[model samples]
Target chain A: MSSKYSNNLIKSADFIQSLERGLSVIQSFSTEHSTLTVSEAAAITNLSRPAIRRIFLTLESLGYLTSDNGRYALTAKVLSLGYAYLSSKNIWEIAHDPMDELVKQTGESTSISVLDHDEIVYVARIHTKRIMTMSLGVGSRLPAFATSMGQVLLAHLPSEELEEYFEQAILSSYTNHTITDKKQLIKQLEQIRKNGWSLAEQQFEEGLSSVAAPITNRNGEVIAAINISTHTGRNSRKEIKEKLIPLLLQTAQKISEDLARSPHPMNL
Target chain B: MSSKYSNNLIKSADFIQSLERGLSVIQSFSTEHSTLTVSEAAAITNLSRPAIRRIFLTLESLGYLTSDNGRYALTAKVLSLGYAYLSSKNIWEIAHDPMDELVKQTGESTSISVLDHDEIVYVARIHTKRIMTMSLGVGSRLPAFATSMGQVLLAHLPSEELEEYFEQAILSSYTNHTITDKKQLIKQLEQIRKNGWSLAEQQFEEGLSSVAAPITNRNGEVIAAINISTHTGRNSRKEIKEKLIPLLLQTAQKISEDLARSPHPMNL
Candidate 1:
């Protein structure tokens, strides 16, 4: 209790608030509301119209936002910030080479992704041409439960964290194969933890199946997950288990070893 | 001058110094100096130690900058800002299908890049197996002259703008084939404009070749450029010109057509 008082007494100035409010305004935007009138943004952030407009103008001048007619939208210049994170000599770069090797040997669409709140964001991908399918890339995010990468990453979390996740997340079915039940998902994660790998058949998208394994650090903690995606119609789960699993596991192990050796962070 | 003065300036109670100082600190940490001590940040931004310490702590709390072992660096959370931009319908969703189709047909690395000052930044890439040899993704930046996409995009600029660019850019040689001379680059851009596509052979990197065409809006002004990259050892310029030229040009045309067909920004 004394420590809490001391923490509050540490006058960090109003600097953090300004930064947070700026970011909060940015976070107000998403796939659903890509473009917003100034008034709408003000409503979303609970900031005054003048405050939001100032931030918007600053962002637009910096090339992170663009306006046409009356509405403002984000521009690709904003990617530079994320690129700074994803391109750091950290986890994504370490796992990339091994991912390439895995794709070479197995010819499967391999990717390394990390958990972001309730979503799974792909940070790297070694795409194979056998399947002409959905759009996926580094920086692409999807529902955590619907991805093989998500299950393996989720399996590593403590029970308390899992419960908190369930409390926050909505388990909407993306495909017929997607697990909608919260209890079933918890059980599946447990199985994934025991098996050291995860196979999600048509979970995220119909006819698109994937298998994933956790990439651990020196402390044996899961930092990220690596996966191979393919069409279920082209290959069976058994074939993936027998042929792709070992290679996938080896890639995961190689990435884990690399993580243990390197001093840089995986995602940061 | 009258129109410029007519532009509304929004006044916000938000602390502008806090935001500017924080961003300056983030921008200070580049690839060269990813880790900086508080003193280093203070020196870089010409802010006092107490002010910088507060800024760093605030940024760390917001997940933009992380402090550890007496050094500060950016975090993956900073990417959320950029991800918000890519989530916009104008760029990511609109360009996804065409990029995929371009990759399918060309069997080369296809990317959607936009101009950021004198350089071109990759906003998205639909990479083929062979092209996966390199690491380039959303936010990756490269000099415009050394890339086909850069050349095509530069071709879109007015002659005075091109001269100003040459004045500002260092024009260093990334490869032996890179155009270091300003006159030569201007001539090349002019050809790219006349022919409707640009080819870069061993320009950005030795043994890598690429072709790019511009994507324009209904106004016939280039808004972005799409490129196809491949290994120079695998194919000749003639092969790319004969095979990929048509595909690249058609893809750009398609994206432009889509942009044209879409409702005007004012309507939205």
Candidate 2:
């Protein structure tokens, strides 16, 4: 099989197509398609009916997927896989107190997110108030070009990887303020790198705004980004810059210092 | 391949062994073993080195696993699997406000947990005060017999299933107060079922006390349990029973009511 991801370097001999297919079957059950039939899963995964049937049976047998009548849905066992990743990273636990403190000080939702492909995945979050229309939570993903956390993380990426990302990204506009142009996004990223932070105003959603800073490891590599999200209606750009950004940066720095001091390595 | 779980009724012909093996590889990475070599993964999963190599490569290619030198670790992409399960159940979002309210009212940590085999996996949590030594988060698992949520969940299980659980359960003692005896546990479960709530005092961890109530679906079958956990040093048993339990039960009832009123089914 051909590699879909450009970063994948493993030889064909080492790759297992069946395992990937099985994971795809599990991924097929999302919010939109919570319960799926065998044929529905087959269609979603683009696998043969026999293949999807086997995958479903395998997942159901393992207790990750449960069958209700003719439809299949994921059970709580699937959470264990994500928990394994979250528990492995001491960063979430280390940043918890600091994130909470940031929320307390700013009275806004504070989150720590890591760069994954073209999106940023929130790993730790503490909400002081829910101001955004979108229901943001741990494990939620947002496009790297449209969100403050994503911009901070993208700003710190290796030059070649960033260039490749720019070459391949779709850059779809969510709002009129969103940077859909590659040249403009690159310029924004460069400015964010120089400023050591980012403030995105109504980029991803109509009234959503956030200020973010990179959280580095002991090696000073930006492993994740932390942000304070507020509403455009509640807080003006000037007020957010003056009040929230400093506290957000301070909390990010404290978390970075704590991460550096931690004996356990922050699993990126 | 033979089925490891008795409840798995799918024929061996339908079960995809490779899929099971692949999931096992993912499961092998935990808090203790965050990064694993091919040989280490092989040993943990009881699969051959070649099999582990293929699984690792497939996972890496899918962006779920990343390799550094000879060690493999999970990336943020893996969180999407857990997010799929979480997003499927709007209950977490629905319960968020009530849980926050409970935490505010009692000044304790509030959580919702669902039974996964012999363990209760925390699905949602809101911490007002950090009282426990153990760092508890969403997806953290605790023994079903030792935790208040676990007891409430176990109490609501059908008679045959509960009997089978008692028969197979190790019932290991976490603290001296933990009820490890089968007969005594059965009696306690009976009382919990009758009372519609449970209060576990220093059962799982010394000084860690919690009161839990079952959250049922429209069918009135106990799908999950919600609890308010406090420290024994902070509040007496009488105070918790009188004050926290009522609030806990009310929140659970409200959640249940909302769940019943919801158009979408709770995918348990």
Candidate 3:
């Protein structure tokens, strides 16, 4: 096939600026604004409506975005691009087998998530037959204070970094059981470090409870966390602590072993 | 956040040209060539080595790519950019539930895949207890003729477009079971239209079998295919025909029902 448009942007740095703008246009849509009219995109990106329309047209042409009734949103093509990233990165490849095994052993909804800025982004999820009440996905993100994965990852932070986290703002409560206070969250994180696991009961959202333990590398550095979420009505804290905790820790250990063995350098 | 540098490429189309060059530099690496030296990137993209080096430096600073031992490749940060694309889409939200039900009914692995040029790209996959030996992944692609999903999608093509597919080049055989003859392949696609599903046994790869059925909207246009892949050792062609065919058809029906019920138009 002809490689007409499939070469490097090496002539000038101008392409870098356009590339950044294109990415920014894509970043404009979120949970709050799933679909937006062209004018709305113009307002959101602060680009002229005409410019936004052209970018939308190009994106749509590229099969990354789609539009209807004057509104534009992303398409499954974007997911393939994400898949490209995930598939190329050996982290998911190595982490998934252990995750699947963990679900088999624990009979709980297990997910592996990494910190992305302020929120915990789920990279992989393994759902047991018993898990049906709550819905979670690979790209799903939740607040750091309200999810077990978030707490365990937070627990690994240095003391100075922890202080900077608290200085940002008040933690908004998702449920009455959520830790909204910064100091209270810090205390909980410290306790999580001591226990080597985190349990969030009715914290992120009511009726949902989860337990998470950090997955570390050979250096004993926490890179991600594995969590199992069950409905609050299904299991007690003591039962989960006894039954699920050992399995989660074992899974984390197996993952760490795999990570250390492969040492596959990530190429995104 | 401020929307800085959000203009369309038309304002400075020269910048768009440069962006294309930069992207070419990034896209030069693949599964086969995960890491490359500056001269290799220049050779692959047909750009000067110094120009490639500067773009590489900028991309490394941008956290998109990384370098070590004078070899450069992408990083995990690329997943974030691709995830940005997925977070902006709503189709997966519409498609996820039906997919779960499909997996529940069929013990085989099922996925929703779309056409990206000549290759069929898996957008989503629902895997059950059985370990999939094949490397077919979310962003993974395969020759359309060698895959059931690809055939179902190919059947939807117009006559001229179908001719374009035939005109392309020799059909590379992935397995002894793969269909290489154009005349026979065309007949099989016609059979898929009559039978309402496409089945392939070790066509794409050895020791794997799959059946794919099309998911259409109210307009009766095929948008995507629902497929179930199982190990050849686990089931024979006769067993698959009797047990899996009906279940596969049912899953396709469920996806179609959900597709019809969706309020948003199927722009993809």
Candidate 4:
């Protein structure tokens, strides 16, 4: 909904169609289809087979893809593209120590993420638990409507922006606990804004609960959010409220204070 | 050097110039240049200002780039691109527990990486110490010849392939302790092949020491390597050999066993 200007840009003579198609092909590969044939890629991306083949060959030549017989799998060089954004931000340098300390204090998995469109993308993570059913990492994404960090991020959005988000976001239920009703979700976000923190009990995944606090910039605008995630059986809601929430808020505040000291984002 | 066939592929009509240029622009933004103006990007990429402006506009339209006046920075959508490769491999699900255990056992930083074109790209990691100068993460890359993981991975390469590696690799010195001499480097590889592990003391970085072991596939081919990295001053050379080496080797072996149990990589 926010990218309506992209329609005009897509029509511009300067817009690169081949680049979009090439990235589309790369995105086509997933857990279910780690490798794909030219035909499979064409069918998935709605490109011609010849066009898909050429893109695959170009990617393979560039060391971003590997060909095994006729099927093409992505190479590790793809990591460089995503890492560019993270490295530019110096996220690991800033977030690792604080998140690691939070994990040590809470003995739960901790993560930091920024709001990306309708989802939240994890930029940094410190996992203390090995047995979480959710096997998430740095690039993992979760629906903004169904996770504590997402709620915190969404809560910080300007009212009109939040309205646009609610209008466009697909409120699909991941679990029975997920808030799919728009009105109900709005109430939760209002409460989160007032409380300065949020909790999601098995909303994203069954038997998992997490509490999150907003991370802000120098001007006190929310830039990102961090969470302490735990299994519901291990940490009851009462203990989470009494024990983990305070530590989570303190870590979030500490990280925000550090971000305030950074020079580049000061202009914001 | 290995991409001679790519020259012919580049000549093909199927090769997409726009795709390559777009990716190059994305790669140009780094720690030093977190954001770039059109002029700066054109200079770095050697594209015309008009062409660069169009590409930047296209990237911004695609939600891959964010613009403030004339300066542009990458957005988190780029994370999804690099994450595609990591998610396809399910790296965290397999490596996290073992790496966490290794960090606990050794009280040091531990990481797993795969060899990508003579460089080791970190695939998984666990951190216990707070003050290591190396602020590393999943997508970090380091020269293979100068680091323990790189050495272990290189040691497992076929003889001709190893020769080709030596033929093309840039053996520039990172520190005074680096083994830039080819004869000496080959001798060390031979010993590492026999010893089934590697230790690099202040080669890649000053005051850092690491010991690594190969993680093999089900068929006994080395696929990746894991390392226990610590301060050379904190753990003496002799103490590293006597204490950390055995624990590091055991952790690597445990990971190799778990990897062997997987069914997909069995075909390798």
The candidate maximizing lDDT is 2
Candidate 4 has a DockQ of 0.45
DockQ of 3: 0.25
Tens digit of per-residue lDDT, candidate 2, span A1-268: 1222366877887788788898887778777887888999888888999988888888888888777677888887888888888777675668878876777787787777888778888877666643221123777888988999999988888787787787777799899999998888889999999998999999999989999999888899888899988988788878887898888889989988888898665356
After superposition, which runs of candidate 4 have C-alpha atoms over 4 Å from their true positions?
A1-11, A129-135, A233-243, A266-268, B1-11, B129-135, B233-243, B250-254, B257-261, B265-268
Q: Where does model 1 exceed 4 Å of error?
A: A1-15, A104-107, A130-136, A170-187, A201-209, A230-237, A265-268, B1-15, B24-51, B65-75, B92-107, B130-135, B175-177, B230-243, B263-268
Over the full model, what C-alpha lDDT does candidate 2 score relative to the true structure? 0.81
Q: Per-residue lDDT tens digits of candidate 3, residues B136-251?
A: 35656778888999999888777777777777745889999999999999999999888989999999999998999998877887878889888988888888889888888887
Model 1 RMSD in Å is 4.8
Tell me the docking grade of candidate 4.
acceptable
Give the per-residue lDDT digits (tens) of candidate 1, residues A1-268: 0110012333555357776777777777776677887899999899989888778776655555677765887766666666656555465557768877887887778887777667887666666763322223556678888889999988887777777678888899888889999889989998999999999998888888889999887778787889998888677767888999999999899888887887653233
Best of the two (1, 3) by DockQ: 1
Higher-ranked by lDDT: 1 or 2: 2
Q: Residue B263: error of model 3 in Å?
A: 1.0
Clashing pairs in 2: none
How far residue B148's Cα lies from its native spot in candidate 3, in Å, is 0.7
DockQ of 2: 0.47
Instruction: List pairs with backbone clashes in candidate 3.
Output: A7-B24, A8-B21, A8-B24, A8-B25, A9-B21, A9-B22, A15-B18, A15-B19
Docking class of 3: acceptable
Query: DockQ of all candidates, in order?
Result: 0.37, 0.47, 0.25, 0.45
**How much is the lDDT of residue A111 in candidate 1?**
81
lDDT of each candidate versus the true structure: 0.73, 0.81, 0.70, 0.80
